[model samples]
Target: MNNINKNQLFWASCLALLVTSLSFGIRAGILGKLGTDFQLTTAELGTITATAFWGFPLAVVIGGFIVDVIGMKKLLVMAFLFHLLGIVLTIFAQGYWTLFISTLLIGIANGTVEAACNPLVATIYSDNKTTKLNHFHLWFPGGIFLGTLIVILFNSLGLSWQIQVAVMIIPTLVYGYLFSKLEFPVTERVASGVSTSTMYKSVTSPLFIFMFICMFGTAITELFTGQWIDVLLKNVTDNAILILTLTTGVMVIGRGLAKPVVHRFSPQGVLLISAILSALGLYLLSTLTGNSIFFAAFIFGLGVCYFWPTMLGFVAENIPKSGALGLNLMGGAGMFAVSVYTIFMGGFYDKLILQKLPEGANEVDYLNATPGSEMADALNLAKNAAGPEILQATLIVPIILTIGFLGLVIYMRSKKTNLIISK
Candidate 1:
């Protein structure tokens, strides 16, 4: 028998997750810089950023299938190795291809963290999976909060973007060191004696299938928009990362109080309310400008704060038979959906910008737009038209989620008492 320190592992998992989210927040913080430095168009940059999202699913899904066999400890070690290589490569990246490959490696590391930790957190807190998962996932936004501040701090000091990228190495090393010494427990499914064949079949259930598809919507609405949100909110404020900071700050607090929230609303009820708030917040953000967007952002943050973990918890609690594979698959599917939408919508963003420009004009012209210059006028026009339309298009997701979750709430109410997760 192993002497497992549950609290130590939980905090280590949070630190590991912090490294993953730091990459995201730092990447988001530097996206515009990468575009400007590389002379990339919005579409090209989107593809570069989406590299991680795509690679994320690949690792998480594969890791899902083998996490049990290879054990969570080894999987997290793999996360550390990949995280180190990926962060180092990113710090030295010379151009687009290098950036793409490095970001992809980081994405795989991020996926591995989830593959191991989601189940780890759930397994340890077997009695309170949803709240504990929320508590663990709070660091996603929490790390993002720290990441944005890092960007702001580095930018304020006139430090190079490479310096900003290097900051990730610190957390990577910390988590790697912690996990290297910790003892891992068997997964809940393995401990409870769920069979592999049974786990496979659970993934195919109608409820599981439905949740899997819904994962697409939630991921897109959160990750896709969050990736480029600086641009989306630029028309409102020059330093839109502050807006993202504000949103994530609220997420940190809201998720800290999740135990009470989860108990009061039930996971399904919380999801329904969150979907409505997300739709409203996205709509307001699509329309509002100046100071008003702050309130909208708070609503948006509160709305999506619980989405990722709660969805996973719903599956784990309601479909206990599905096991580690199921949880990882759900997380994998969400990232995969974000990967697809980021590229597709990115292309659409470029197309819309193209229509707003003169026949020979390109994004570089817009990027280099100077006050009162022809390209400046064209850039202004595109910002007025294309950007809002992109946000408006994304708004449909949370709106649809509102409808979906409303149905979910009703459906949960109709279920047999034993299947219910409500208070």
Candidate 2:
């Protein structure tokens, strides 16, 4: 540990992760603007958003395989360069393809940060990996809180979305400077003398494979819905982005108190309760409206608050042999699932809207119908029903999560003391 500045490296990572999360929050805020400005349909916008998730898994999975050989510093430098390129490309985006490419680059940068930092935090605080991991991950939501507030402020000030995006460059540059002078530690796998081949093989274990699949449910439940919240809940409430700000606000606090919660419930216990609350929250959002929406978002924030970090912690503590590969693959799997789910969720929204329209009636037909006429009434149904209907479809993800976490908690209990404690 000589010459290594743990505090500097750690906060640099928080700031880097901050940049990644800020991108998510800002993109969520501007999704509607991008769609309207580019004359895009919802499906086209979804494909552009999905491009970001697609690039994420590609970069993080590849980084996982190579980080040991190339070092964290090189991967972080890659993230720095990608962040700048993505921002520049997005600010100048002329159409669909340009937006897609720019968002993809940003996703790659986001994934690279996770690839380098998750294991970095785990390596530095070896005695308390899970608790510290949660502390580090608190910044993900903390950044979103800041980003969403920035977006709300920008919108109020009448700033362009481009300027809102460019704000990320400040933190990106700050983290970039901090990292340039800091020394990095070896990954947990390397420090513990685990062989590369063994690390590769460990992720194939029955437990790891189970978590990988479960990750699909947990991640899509949180991310796909989050990225689409502006579009999905817009019909139900005039200020839907406020729900996002509210949910992430709850998440910031929830993650900050992770230690006591983990102590009281154990990691498996935490997953079980999180799954239940998340399911309830989604159900309420699908069913409720008006001021009640904030209540649902708060429930969701509490439910998902501990999910990402705890999932990684469970693997790190119970399956230590899997090491860095396990952690990276776990995070990568979630993003990959969301990549595909976003397209499907978008299609679901488009399909619902189409279904609400009379056969052979396009959106133009609806627009052309005379107000107060029976024909206009037919399309008004689509406008009023589409958002809630798509949210109803999302119920399936969290429903599955509830069952899966239940089984995990029960299994850990039956095993009775070996892996249940999480540390």
Candidate 3:
């Protein structure tokens, strides 16, 4: 048996989760200033921000294979070093390539953390996996709440955004200390002395496949909103910082309140409702003008809050035997899927909005012109030309959510039937 107390395990999980959340906050919260600092086109910045995700899928895939071999303790220590170096390099990135490299390294570290910690948490609290996992994972957004506030504060202080990015080191160091001092539990699935053959078989099971698909759509939904909100809000206002701050604020609140909300409704039910609201919210956001867009963002934030962490919780409860390898495989798969989606969206945004701008029209004009409205004609004369492609691309997310919701419904019904029959 591990010598560590339950409180140590709980706090270690919290600190690890907080680091992940901080990474996201830094990614989204500093969007506008980073764009300005690098003099990057909106399309270019999208690619840069999405670069970290490029490494995520690979790391998780590899992490799953090695986590059991290498042990969680080794991985957690490496996560700190990787994230620290990545953050330091990001601070000095003078151009896009440097930023891209930094993001890729950070992604690997972040992915490794996911691989180690998810399994650790599940094993640590295997008895109440759902409830404990939900509580443990809350810091993912808790960091975002703190991160968003930091962005606002840094702006008020007139500090370099570069410095703000570097500030990630603080939490990185703090978490490193916590993880270093704590004793970690062995993988529960492995601890029972199960054969490696059995563990692999569990991962390949049919239920695992369903959870994978569910997580794939879930990842796309969560990341699409997080990565794109800053860019999307640009359509709503010239005060890009303020708009991003508002969106991040809503995310913080929604995630903070997720546990209570989840207690009332099951994770699957929460996802089902979220998908509908997110789809409706995205449509409203993409089409609305002025103040309505702000409200739309709030609605979208509400819809996205539970999708990511709750999905992790679901896997913990439903697939206790697969352990962290299962969590890493699924979580990493979702992020990998999101990266691919983001790349596609980036290409469409560039071709449809950025590269093909008209001679004199501003992007703001293109955003404000309603579909089939005469303003599009007047606006088309400006600099940028608006196309239906971007609008169509935005709709893909909602379509995905609908498909995912159907899958969840089937899974829920099947699970219930299995339980009753087994009983």
Candidate 4:
């Protein structure tokens, strides 16, 4: 049995994730500011946000292969440095290129944290992989709650956005200190002496392939909605920030309760139910308005709360031989999906605005219009017209995911029966 301090490592991991989540929240809050200050079009802003996921897959994939070789401590040190550097770059960003590069660095750091810590936690708590992973992932939404609260607080105080970004430095430093001098156990795959060739083969197997494809849809459902929530709800509701906070707040509670849910429903069953809820939630968000928006967001939050961690948990439990690389690839795939979808959604919004605008109106003039001005009013009108269509388009992803998970549930049930008979 491993003798290291699991609690310290777990909390340290949570702090690291907290930093990532804070970064995400702060970035979401600043998107409007970025567009205003930089005079960026909606599509340009989308490209910038997409940059946040661009480097993630590369870092996680590379980190997964070498994590066991360099150890978690070293990977974490790299994460700290990248995060620090990325924040500095973001604070000083002057234009699209600078913001893109800065966000990409942060993406790499976020991916490294996921790559190192998921397996670290799985290794430390091997017996309850799914439940523990759910507990570990609680920090994600928890941090979002804190970060959104900070934004709401800071905005009320009239502080600069830089101050909001700077607040993340505190948690980053704390996590760095916690990780320092701590020993990390080898990955379960390495400990079991599973050769790398076998690991490679496991990822290529048909089941893994199916899950990988489903991950794309699941990620699009959760992340595309999340990253664009503020923008999507800007004109629809006055409480966009609170709505964002409330959404993540619901996620925090749901993830905290995941242990019992997993005990009752099996991971596959839980995923199936989550998929159905997610699809329904998205459809509601696309079609409904007024007081019902909160209800839709609540359902969406409950649906996605378990997605990222649960997907990782399923792989950890079902495909133990695939090791850290498997977890890394799963994370990488999700972020990659988000990256593509962000840009696509941005373009979609841009196209819709053009369609809604009156003949001979200038797109650039509307895009760069100051808030409360006539041009800005026209732009908001176009956004209101187009927003529902964009959201409806996003619903396709979750609907597909619902069907896929239903099939997986049936397959797993049959597999379990055969194993019971063999026993």
Candidate 2 TM-score to native: 0.94
For model 1, residues 1-423, the per-residue Cα lDDT tens digits are: 259999999999999999999998999999988977877778888899899998899999999999999999999999999999999999898889999999999999999999999999989999999999999999999988998999999999999889998988988899999999989999999999989999999999999999999999988887887778886567778788987898899989998999999999999899888888888878887888889989988988988988999999999899988999999999999999999999998899888888878888767768776768877777767866777688889988988888998999888878956456565
Name the candidate that leads on TM-score.
4
Can you write out model 2's per-residue Cα lDDT over 1-423, one digit (the tens) per residue?
898888889999999999999999999999989976876777888889898898888888888888888889889999999998998899999999999999999999999999999888888888877788899998988887788888899999999999999999999999888888889988888888999778878899888999999888888888887888888887677778888899989988998899999989999899889998998998888888889989999998998898899999999888887877788898899999998989887777777878888888786555557778887687557756898777788888878888888899888887777556655
Ranking by lDDT: 1, 4, 2, 3
lDDT, candidate 4, residue 316? 93
Residue 123 miss distance in model 1 (angstroms): 0.7
Pairs that collide, model 3: 358-383, 358-384, 360-382, 360-383, 361-382, 361-383
Per-candidate total of colliding backbone pairs: 0, 0, 6, 0
Candidate 2: Cα lDDT at 158: 99
State TM-scores per candidate.
0.96, 0.94, 0.86, 0.98
Estimate, for each residue in 1-423, the C-alpha lDDT of model 3 and write its tens digit: 558677876787677667767777767877756765666665677677677787777777788888888888888898889889888988988888998898988888888788887787777777766666656666765676676677778878998778778778887898888888877777877787867777677789887887787777767766766666655555456544454455556666666566677777777777788888777766766677677767876776677667777777777676666767778888888988888777777666655653455556465555455756765554433212332235445667667777777687777879899999999
Error of 4 at 288 (Å): 2.2
| TM-score of candidate 1 relative to the true fold | 0.96
Tens-digit lDDT track for model 4 on 335-408? 99999999999998998988888888888988777889988898889888787788889888888888899999
Better of 1 and 3 by TM-score: 1
* lDDT of model 4 at position 328: 93
